[model samples]
Target chain A: MIAIDFLGAIGRLFLGFLQAIGTLSVFTANAVSHCVRPPFYFRSIGQQMLVIGYFSLPVVGLTAVFTGMVLALQIYEGSSRFNAESAVATIVVIGITRELGPVLAGLMVAGRVGAAMAAEIGTMRVTEQIDALTTLATNPFKYLVAPRLIAGTLMLPVLVLVADIIGVFGGYIIGTSKLGFNPATYLRNTADFLEAIDVITGLVKAAAFGFIVALMGCYHGYSSKGGAQGVGAATTNAVVSASILILAADYLITELFFSK
Target chain B: MAVDTRIPKVSLRDVHVAFGPKKVLQGFDLDVMPGESVVVIGGSGTGKSVMLKCLLGLVTPDRGSVKIDGQEVVGISDREREPILQKFGMLFQYAALFDSLSVWENVAFGLTQAKGMTREEAKPIALKKLAQVGLGADVAELSPAELSGGMKKRVGLARAIAIEPEIILFDEPTTGLDPIMGDVINDLIVACVKDLGATAISITHDMASARKIADRVAMLYQGKAIWQGPAATIDKSGNAYVDQFIHGRAEGPIQVEVRA
Candidate 1:
């Protein structure tokens, strides 16, 4: 009897996971289809772009700056033991432009923008505002989901590009001022070693991360049930899921782009 | 020979919906005629809202057909359903106004977004609808969060009528209002429906609201409509369940489910 019960529990868990994936796949397809369809709400798309991209700049910038500064200091300490301190500039630029800048910005935006999207959309769901949209002959996918998805995918690349520049600047500041390194030498080192593909890869990763963040937020919130407590759960789930997916996608995309 | 060309504005036949082990509706049926006002009365958690959602295609029934204007709406694609949905206008329990938009924008959303009218063209009509609901032009720019409960309901009602729909649904329209305000809303609903000659379907536990707005009253119990009659004859409905519900008595044929 115990063996039967254990197998039953495991089976249920597997089924639940599969069901969630299926639902998310369907939701993604619907959102993408609506994104290209006409009767588009250009004004709403513009508004969401401003919210997801423009309003998110400061936090992403601050995170990138601090990360670059700390990385430069750490790389300097480790490299000094082997008479390789001068190599810190090259490593910091490569690391910031290729990985840390985009990943950190993606996670930060996931926490900030993802949670807000979930809360706002979840509240709308519980309150029946979504249903009201349907009754008024408006498709919630076109009116709500599609715009956010488009804006998030298109604008994260832009935000990540800005973050990459700011992070490199941060490394420059620490390298010249704190390390007693000549500013021209450090910049020359960084420019010589950094390839365009590194920056391009980060931007592509940011686009994927942005799409994941927005999609998770919307899917969880749209399916939220119960009431206030349900909306709260949806908000939490959106952040957790988006953060996890960003990390997972980062790894996969890095393997695709840079594997030996 | 006179042809009876008027089809039921909304109809559901043997509808059933369940969540896990709990069945919300079982073999439920209702037919609402054109230009008629019907009020569905039931206790909390008795699936009144679920029935409304089923009719609106927000919640799909596990079994049965939902029809609008004698055409089957169940199992149809959203693209095919859009034209049929355009006939409906719903006033939600909490007003459910979009907090992201200004009051005027909320009222004009269907016209400007769904019907492809320009904002400039829809603005005057939105203002006219607001005036019909006794709201001043000053209220148009205010956020929904800034409005009182009564004011929110009025804004919601104004938005519902802005498109001049042939069918209007009210989901607990007077639920959270004071008695006087509830009466005022009831009067407004009656006047608006009469002026437009629209079919109205409302669900409420408020007998006062039912008395004021209903041409016919249907009382639901055990997922089936147990008693139905003309509004004036509710006092003499002759069913013990209806008697218990109308009199607000705890002891009756209907048992309240109290979960531990």
Candidate 2:
């Protein structure tokens, strides 16, 4: 009986996995169709940019600064054991630009903007505001989805660029002043080791991460069921799904950009 | 032969809508002639709102057709839908005001966003509409969150008429208001629809509102319109379902679903 129960559990898990994948595919299809439609809502895009990007700056900036400072200290300590303390500048620049900037930005946005989008839109769905928009001859997608998608895609790269600069600057301050490194040599090493591809790859990752975050937010929100409880679930699901997608996509993009 | 020659501003024929296995609307038929105010009344979950949504093209009927000004709406392209939509204004149950914008901004959203009117051009028109619904210019600068329930409904009414739409839909417009406020909203709805010479379709369980605002009243039950008649004749609709609803009797033809 225990064996039979275990087998049943396994079968249920498998079905659940398939159901999740199927739902995600349906969401992706709906988002694509909504994105391509007309009666584009430029105002929604601007509002989302204000909400998701501009308001998010202080937190993203602070996180990047601290992350850079810590990375420099850790790299300095680790390299000194191998008698290669001079590699601190290279590690800080490359690490911040290639991986940390985009990933952190994605995760932060998933927490801040993604959750907010899901909650707002999900509440609207539950309360029938989306239905109201439709009845008014307003395409909820063109009015709601397109703007968030466009704003998320466009603003993320700009945010990531700022994060990368702040992150590098944090490392420079810690490395030169605290670690007793020569400022000129640290600056020169940082410039020499980081290539255009590294920065460009991070920006590309930022854009992809932005798309995933916004799409998941809008999809879960638009399709949210029940009332308050359902909207809460959608918010949680949006953040989790967006965070996972961002990490997975970051890996693929990194491989594409750097792998021989 | 004598002809039924009145031109309907909106009409639906054999409309059927389903969500998966649950049929929300089934072979629903309705006609509202130009400048007529029609109220659809039913208990919760009886498809009154769904019928209204179908006519608005918000929920596409799976079978049959909806026509606005004699133009079939079900399968028309977006370009074909826009002009039809421009003829519509809707006041939702919860007001559905944009929380980010001030009251006037919400009222003028369609005007500024869809009609290409500058904020300066739209503000006075929005204020004028607000005044028509008895809101002062001081309320225009306040966000939706700050407004009382009655105020929000008035703002929604203002927004609905801002563009002078030829048709208006009111979904449970008096659901949460006090009796006095509800009467005020109903009177405002009647005045606006009359002033605009607009055909109106409203769904509500508020019989007081229905009596105050409707030229004709229809009762929906079990996914179909069970009875329809001129407002003066609703008391003698003769159908058991309609009698049960208007009289608020629990022991009549309408069965309340009590979960055991």
Residues A84-124 of candidate 1: C-alpha lDDT, one tens digit per residue: 99898899988988899879988998898888889888989
iRMS of each prediction: 1.0, 1.9
The sequence of per-residue lDDT tens digits that candidate 2 reaches over residues B63-97 is 98899988899987766887788888999989888
Instruction: Please estimate how well model 2 matches the true structure, expressed as its whole-model Cα lDDT.
Output: 0.88
True contacts kept of each: 0.87, 0.39
The list of candidate 2 runs beyond 4 A from truth reads: A1-44
Q: Of the true contacts between chains A and B, what fraction does model 2 have?
A: 0.39
lDDT comparing candidate 1 with the true structure:
0.91
User: What TM-score fits each model?
Assistant: 0.96, 0.92
Candidate 1: Cα lDDT at A39: 74
Residue-level lDDT for B7 in candidate 2 = 67
Overall lDDT per candidate, in order of appearance:
0.91, 0.88
Clashes of each: 0, 0
Best by DockQ: 1
TM-score for chain B of each model, two decimals: 0.96, 0.97
Question: How far off is residue A236 in model 2, in Å?
Answer: 1.5
